[model samples]
Target: MATNDNVYRLQGLSCMNCAAKFEKNIRAISTVEDAQVNFGALKLTVKGDATIAQLEKAGAFDGIKVLSENEPPPENTTPFWRKRESITTIISLFFIIAGYVLYFQLEPKSPFTIGTFALAIIIGGYDLFKVGLKNLVKLDFDMKTLMTIAIIGAAIIGEWGEGAIVVFLFALSEALESFSINKARKSIRTLINIAPRKAMIKRGNSVEELNVEDIRINDIMILKPGEKAAMDGEIIKGESSLNQATITGESIPVHKTFGDEVFAGTINQEGYLEVRVTKRVEDTTLSKIIHLVEEAQAERAPSQQFVDKFAKYYTPAIMAIALLVAILPPIVVGASWTEWIYLGLAVLVVGCPCALVISTPVAIVTAIGNAARNGILIKGGIHLEETGRLNAIAFDKTGTLTEGTPEVTDIVPTEPYSEADILSLAHAIEAYSQHPLASAIIKKAKLVEGKKVNAENFQSITGKGAKAVINGKEVYIGNSVLFEEIGSLPRESKQRISSLQAEGKTVMILGTSNEVYGIIAVADQIRKSSFSIIDQLFKLGIQKTIMLTGDNKTTAVAIGNQLGLSETRADLLPEDKLTTIKSLQQKYGKVAMVGDGVNDAPALASANVGIAMGGAGTDTALETANIALMADDLEKLPYTISLSRKALHVIKQNIAFSLGLKIIALLLVIPGWLTLWLAIIADVGATLLVVLNSMRLMRAGERSSIENNV
Candidate 1:
């Protein structure tokens, strides 16, 4: 039994409705003393002796699921009808059909028509009456109150059919809204389920399977040829090609060898390896990604905040309007009471709020789905909307635009030795060292199949260089700083090193027996897609592209020029990059920062939209950024921006079309030109039209010919 303060993360939440249902259902369990769900946070907090497993079973309700029990419940509450939405929908439809049949097929004023009207009232209007009465006591005039008043006023004036239609259409629209929200939240649930439940651990040349939580750091884990690594670790032996699509969204497999890092939840495609766990279950990359995603979902965007504020006032104000329509129109025009009451009912049906409530969510869901299909995962609707409006983009140079790994591209020798000879001797000394630049030289030398010359009395100097006896001769492999400490640099070698440095290459000098032999220049390669992505951004209406990098100015400018960027800042640490992003935002109004490494976390969080490159397995990037690009391919950036813009455009069209139609209908209602059937058609027809329009976002790839263009 855990203490009263214990908290657990709950998974399998499909929507706010599911969260609410789980919370309500869990309260019925005896050991569950109390449970509160923070739907906004996607967590459930429980204070009781109930174990996680017990709480999970107890919290399961119809259409509701409980995930891990270690965290508090989410804050979002369930909708009223989710538990029995299907039943309510069926009942509402039946009443609508019966009412229409009885009114049209039977004689006017028939007993069947009256009975049908009564059934409609009970089926559709009962919930509205109960909600209105409850809210009326709290002085909270909700949408239900507006609806109840309109229906009752119609019944009072002998317009029972009109009242029935209003409630029926409203009920149907609410059900649809609930369903759409559930669909929007399904992606999060799917992502949470990807974490592995168990791990294969190697113990004393034997293997045993255990729960993921029971595995510890530094444990030797054996990953078979086709198994997913269950935790983050380094390959201690063997080699494999891993399909990292689950993490990076890249369809291609990445080759991994000794000393390379492997993440849990990524499938190993070929070969087998023994890995030394570098991270525990809780700290694994997959866990961090899950944790970060949950947090990002809870964060409200500025536009969503506006919607929340509008909902608070919009419901009450509409109720007052319905009352005015019901009472004042009859008094002003000397119209029959029933006619004015029917006009009030029209207003209630028009103000169902289906359009307003779903406007943002529909666009959000469509945008997220579209983005995901194109290898980008936008954490929330807010990010999609905000990113679409960005005026400028800031990028981290290394890893984002250029491959971070340095490679030896050019080697120049002085008087006594050729390039191959210099490389061979240098590789002999560097093979014993683990420095990045040293590794690059050694890798290149190995490509040439150079002889491995053993060194005697090898000594490494921290941050300076290395000295060793190679072939009974003293060999020094390091920078000019190390040589300056011993003797003056040779004229030819000094000139070559200076030239390479000016060309933005890191120069490493190799010397033998007090004479400088040769120089190797290493540089990071530009990603093949970077230039094209920058060009695509221009076509997408982005006004500026800026590069922020820790690399030196020469290298940064070379890459920036290749991409035709307008601004470039080099030699920036992580904090400096963040400052640069802030300054750009202050100048340009809105800026998006994109990077692919853990160091980019702060800047990614601070930007108007933080976009992570190759984010599939990088948890910090995925969680911190508003959007994550799963593939290393940068071409998707423009596609994502286009999708978001199109989604927002669709939302605007729906809102305008729905509102315009409603206003025109209200005007006609007062003049007696619009009847009960017309009001119902207008309400349902407009809702369906908006829904179809929102669905256009799903087909944006086809509509815009994005695939063909790409």
Candidate 2:
């Protein structure tokens, strides 16, 4: 993240084991101090100085090509059948079929028949043997090393036809593994291609098409109906409905007008608009989402780390078992040496670590990519896994559960002062304040004509209210606590404040040091979607839905009852919210805290998972929270939890299925029933099934309406 100079992207990096070995080779270079390969992301980060040629040479065994992070990935224009891997497999298959015909038609020991089988083996296993033999010499025990030993040992035993067929099967399996990885990476590729490469910039008089990279901040972009935005900006003129499904996962077309922020890759519908660019192409929301998703892929899940550690020991143990199978049967039991050795070779083929090594990463990658496409940014696999197990969730009341836009609902005045007098005096003190309650009083004051009075020496009271000097008198505007401190409240005033507070409205007292002037009430409306979201959380097995707020207990309880919350903690400071999160974790196994990302920083950080709302175009929201919902609405909360649970389930299933199949195939060695091709088939079948299972995550969420229309 510091700079792109040392980070590079990789092509043809499909095997996790090969990636690990390649990283070590790069670090061995004298100029390189450290190297790490993120197999899930197919990226490499090298510390110290290293040339591209040097990095490429390190990965040459796997045919990996290194490209600068900024470079665009090359398009695959060649037909699949014409690609190098496919062509090699096809030619090898033809030779194997011809060899089979010659073995039956001519003598089994004929020179031509054996030559054809040897040609098949050489052609199909060139890359495999190249990497496998090098690993063999180093005393490494990867799948390739096991595979190389199996095929060569079979050839030395004079099983020419079996060796050639096994070679073709292994090559075909490798091709399928590559294809499946690419398929899982398609979501990331779609995100990269969402924004247009060119934009129409309004330069002085005439509009001209220009590349997005050439456009700068403050440039005016001309957008017409049915056009996608090329950069992030605010609309300066015109209005339209824009489909932002690709960015926020909201399928509906949201209406956008002057001053509304628009992100790149969103389609503008039914209006011509001019936008003032706010951010460069790389700084857009879509670009950040893409980068975060890639980084999430690189962060290994607990299951992935476990599998990687397990395979380190699992691979070497398989070799030991194979060696024992070959020696003990021939020496201890007096079985035929040729037949028992062949069985040992089959055991090596069955024990290839491909399926187990690939099982968890494929699932993690697919789930993270899918979550990004749905407008939910899951920061890493650890958070994704934690979300699935959350039993309790804490919510911040003001901006998260409520609309956050407070309005002036009621104003009461003493007998000496009129409504106009109260509005004017309160607006004078609150006008300079930036709080949401201040905005509401200011808005209501504008609608009613009030006395033109200005307050001097204004000061804001933290956690209480604001005060200023009006007509040489010290006036105060805050809650009952400030008023009670200055002067005793009359019984009527107390009753009136209590009534308003019970109605879920925030009551602010307006008075001077000696006598009370009146009471002003402001209320923030709850979001319409809040009730259903709470219900959905309950149905999803969330045990406790607690609300944390700084409001009075009366108001907090009033709002909590309406939303059916299980608990409410009112009059809480930022630190109190954090303590509550820790308490919830103690009571429940895991807890999630949802807030506006900035205000609830302490609580969000303390909770097991922090969810931020309205992440689109907001950099702080993206950076601060563990999970960010792009849209301002809470409709996606249930969907995110559902997807995470499904991902966890699939990851477990893939791991169990991969290891289970290998164990069953290893059992076949007891009866001497496993053949070279059959062992290869079992490994290939398990790998293919695991990949397909992980890909189910791509279709887990509902299809966006824009996709439906397309």
**Which structure among the candidates has the greatest TM-score?**
2
Candidate 1: 10-residue stretch with minimal lDDT: 701-710
lDDT of 2 by residue, 580-663 (tens): 899999999799999988889899888999999999987878998899999987888878777777788888989888888888
lDDT of candidates 1 onward, in order: 0.72, 0.87
TM-score for all predictions?
A: 0.78, 0.86
lDDT of 2 at 258: 99
Clashing pairs in 2: none
